[model samples]
Target chain A: MARLFKPRMLALAVLAALASRAHAEPAAAPARAEVLHWWTSGGESAAARTLADAFRAAGGTWIDTAVAGSEQARAVAVSRVAGGNPPTAALFNASRQFRDLVDQGQLTALDDVARQGGWDRVMPPAILDAVRVNGHVYAAPVDIHMTAWIWYSKAAFKKAGIAAEPRSVEELFQALDRLRAAGLIPLAHGGQPWQDSIVFRAVLASVGGRDLYLRVFRDRDPRAIESPEFRQVLLTFRRLHGYVDAGSPGRHWNDATGLLVAGRAGVQIMGDWVRAEFSAARQRAGVDYGCLPGLGEHAPYVIQADAFVFPKNRDAATARTQALLATTVTSPAVQVSFSSRKGSLPVRSDVELPSPDPCVALAAALMRDRARQLPNDEMFLTPDQAGAMADVLTAYWNRDMPVETVQKKVVAALRDDL
Target chain B: MRATWAARAALVPVALTALLGYLGSTLWTAQMSVTASRTLPSDHFVGMAQYVRLFSNERWLLSLDNLLLYGVLFISACLLAGSVLAILVDREIAARGWLRQIFLYPYAMSFIATGAVWQWILNPTDGIQAVGRALGFSAFRFDWIVDPDRVLLTIVIATAWQASGFVMAILLAGLSGVDPDLWRAARIDGIPTWRVYTSIVLPQLGYAFATALVLLLTGVVKLYDAVVAMTQGGPGTASEVPTKFIMDHLYGRANLGLASAGAIVLLVTVLALLAPFLYARTRAAASIA
Candidate 1:
């Protein structure tokens, strides 16, 4: 009885101490903000630290919660928000990902912050449209990522006797053939579903043209899916699968990029994130490697962005902290620093990169031409629809399905009723 | 004797936790399955729609097929390999402890680590296939990890390697309990050692085999981590399992209603498979009493 009594008394004493310490904290404790993001990789975390530093300089406390994978991070953020203890801010792709949160009144609108920052003038129209839902802004745009870049190893190209960059789909195939003849892996592809869909998007943008791409993805027109042009795009996408090595299945995106960095593979159709890998290997863009936004001169530029949304919080101090974070991340100086380190284009067009990278410069040049600017499918499709479409595309990519059957599957997958 | 009131009072918290935590959440999930829940659960009733969509989903159907194939192969391989290992270890070997540790080491590692190691070993470009080619065997090929039809088999091989060790330990424990007098009697009767093992010793290990089967079956149903660490339901969804499907919908796709329906289906499957075994066990116990 004495032993039990002593431990219980000690536990009560500890609890009393903890409660007193909690009560003793100053009422004006620096407006604390916990930012949830999926940026734990070396370069990505460095980029995220810039935002944390800026927030600290702005007289607010910055708590960083970095989850390793985007899907997992968003899952945690969503569940936390549902569980009623959401972070001060959580990262999301600037797309329909957070549309449900807005519809459910779970996100705090950022109209005041948007107006103060002149977001209407600074942000590109595509990104601005993504953040503004029902005449109120719900997300703060951070960086722009173009998804359909063709990254190739110059060493592999030269060894395969390719003289210049392929400017058309026909020329790209010829280059792939030359690389294969040289006994090299022609395509450095990771066989994950998302990576497979990236290749499909590149093919759709280059082969199907902007109109067909929009019709198939944005409009979800069944006619567009079954058309001969779309079939040709599917055929081209599958044709490139022949160039991949036997070890392509389940290979990670970075490992695939490593192939190009090592000059073992000729080309990889991925997003601008691959630049981080090349740079990590000390390969300079336009020197050791080259990036083409797409195969054709006027191919559609499929763009996506990483942004932050403030989960609805009733606390006045937290609201102020959230607004401060929004303004700090979107400022011109912060945008430039974050984008340069993160291998993405700055969300604000007004910012100037201190030292421009060749690939980013190319993307910036393409961004100015509003005629070629297109939103990636994620911006238009709900998360569920996007996943379903990915399933069809990946199945088609890995299997020997007929083009007509694939078209049927795509139409079914994109049906809004489901 | 009746349990004391103090003991019953002491069990209140645990009893309440079981009733509310497990049973209550299970009921909530069933209710959610019948609603039009997406990113968050809503009260809007949409009966049978999510289940309809789940059944029609090609990925879900393929996942079920893969789970079936994986279940049969993984369980049989683990049982056979475990029995052989237990028999081998039961002999009076000089390095019994070392052999036991060596066989059981993989069970100590997480499925993720085991999956990663096996993935590297089975990769065609730089794994065993490359070594075979390097040794002047130009025609050698073992690229099943990337083949759409054969990727599920690779998962079976990986998970079986991780779980068979555990099954071996169970069987070895059961083997140790076998009567030494029966062995002496068999020796006096001049019965062969292999015959004694097959005809007499194995029959006595029924409870151990049942326990191992239950563990292996649950492992088969929850076969997500190894698949994720290795194939991630790819070479185009060929290695997908039911748990992976439910998880993808639950979080990544934000279709909670469909995910809940999948969970209920998996629960029903497990209950159906375990019912007869549990009933038989109860009957056997009652007869012994």
Candidate 2:
């Protein structure tokens, strides 16, 4: 009982200290920051270390709190903020994910840091717009992750007798068919709902093209969803279902990546972060494996970013640390190093690639073209709408649901946005 | 077992905990179900909209069906296997103590570790089927782990493997208390052993079976960990249960309104199913008294 009571007393003491700090007098305290994020993977951990190291160099003490999954991490962060023990910084995707939190005045905007770093000019429009909610920067953008990259095993491609990267959707399917004929698993896919949504979005961008894809996702246009083009995309997505093995269902994305890693499967449509897996397996990009960002020239570069948001904290010392940490993380030195390890492009366009991987270099070049910049579904859809849309895609993937029904459901899912 | 002042005082903490933790949250959930809450609770009430949306959802519907299939199959299989194991040990079988310990061993382990191991063993491509082929039994197949139509049964198998031993332990205690004279009289009458056990011993084990049944039922309703560890309610929502659906909405989708609504519906269902059983139990007790 004494042992138990001791921990409870200590917890209460900490809570009391935090409570008093919420109304603490302005004092010149040492810079200390508590950062909460969902970046527990090996590559992500190293990326976090870069930021931590940078903050330490910038005269701040960095405290790291990493949760394994985004949903759980965000929940913990939000609860902490609500419970009056908000961390100095919490990581959120550069999307409408934090819109309500900002509305409730729970976030500290980093407009000063944004101006100091010239974020307006360097950041891509999609990411810039995401962080700059209501003309104030609510998050410090770290890295840009492209969502529509098609990764392939070079060995599998060789066995399939493929000569070069397919430049068009038709050619891409032809390559998949060749891989299928070679008696290898053509598409190594995890059948989780999110994974299903990834495949669907990849198909939407590659097969449906830029305008159709943007209209359905960004505009939530009902007519666009009902269009023949969207129908074709849906059909194409359903057709790829036949390419995966029986073990694809309920499999993790990393396990699916392992199929490519082992040369047992040909291709996987996933984010740029797959580079970490290749790196771990000692498979050099453009040699052991290859990446195609999209179908062709007409395809837009789909951008998803991870950013840090400061929780509402009035303590002078904590606010100072938050500012220091935000500025340090977005600085070119930190962004370049962090993004490289994180398998994402630096948020800053100014940073020159140092030891750039092949796929990342291609994505960076594509990201430079303003017209080709498109945000992922999360940026456009509320988390609710995105989840509903995922359900529609997953249902279609797992069942013999007709393409027409899927089209109607997709429109209904975006009805709130409409 | 007398209710004393110290015992009554002791009940204070448990009572307070139950009132605040269970009843308080349940009321809050009921209130939230009527609101248009996104990530957090809000006061703006939109009555029944969430409930309506929940029913309209294909994923929710599929989860309910999976839960029903899983519940019926999991409980029955556990009861059957548990009873069989108990009876086998009861007959003074060879290495009875060792066999009893082996049967109860799975109960001591956690579902998380067990489920993950089961996932690997049941994985079709490189797990059981691959092993079978390697051992020259290429015709052997157990791809139900990935099959959409049959995935819930795989959940049943994995959960039963963990839960059956628990049931066996309960039944064994009930078997021990059975009258020795009933067995001796049955032996004199030349009744078959299976008939004697079923007609005599099984009827007397009703109280024990009820206790086991109630526990197993609760397990079925709160079935989250096994599904999460084993299948994550996927292969595209094929194995999603109501708890997973509610959790996904409550956190992942940030639709607490829908999640609360789901909770309400699930609660009503459990009550509806339990009311008759509870009423019948009271009636039986009243008649005896």
Predicted model with the maximum TM-score: 1
Q: What is the C-alpha RMSD of each candidate to the true structure, in Å?
A: 6.7, 5.0
lDDT of 1 at A16: 35
Candidate 2, superposed: residue stretches over 4 Å from native = A1-30, B1-4
Q: What is the per-residue lDDT of model 2 for residues A78-112, given as tens digits with 9 covering 90 to 100?
A: 76776777878888899888877887888988999
Model 1, retained fraction of real contacts?
Answer: 0.73
> Each prediction's TM-score against the native?
0.94, 0.94
Runs off by more than 4 Å, candidate 1: A1-30, B1-3
Error of 1 at A348 (Å): 1.0
- Per-residue lDDT of model 2, residues B112-173, tens digit only: 78988998999997798889989999798889888878888889999999999889999999
Best by lDDT: 1
Give the lowest summed-lDDT range of ten residues in model 2 chain A. Answer: A1-10
Q: Score the docking of each candidate (DockQ).
A: 0.52, 0.43
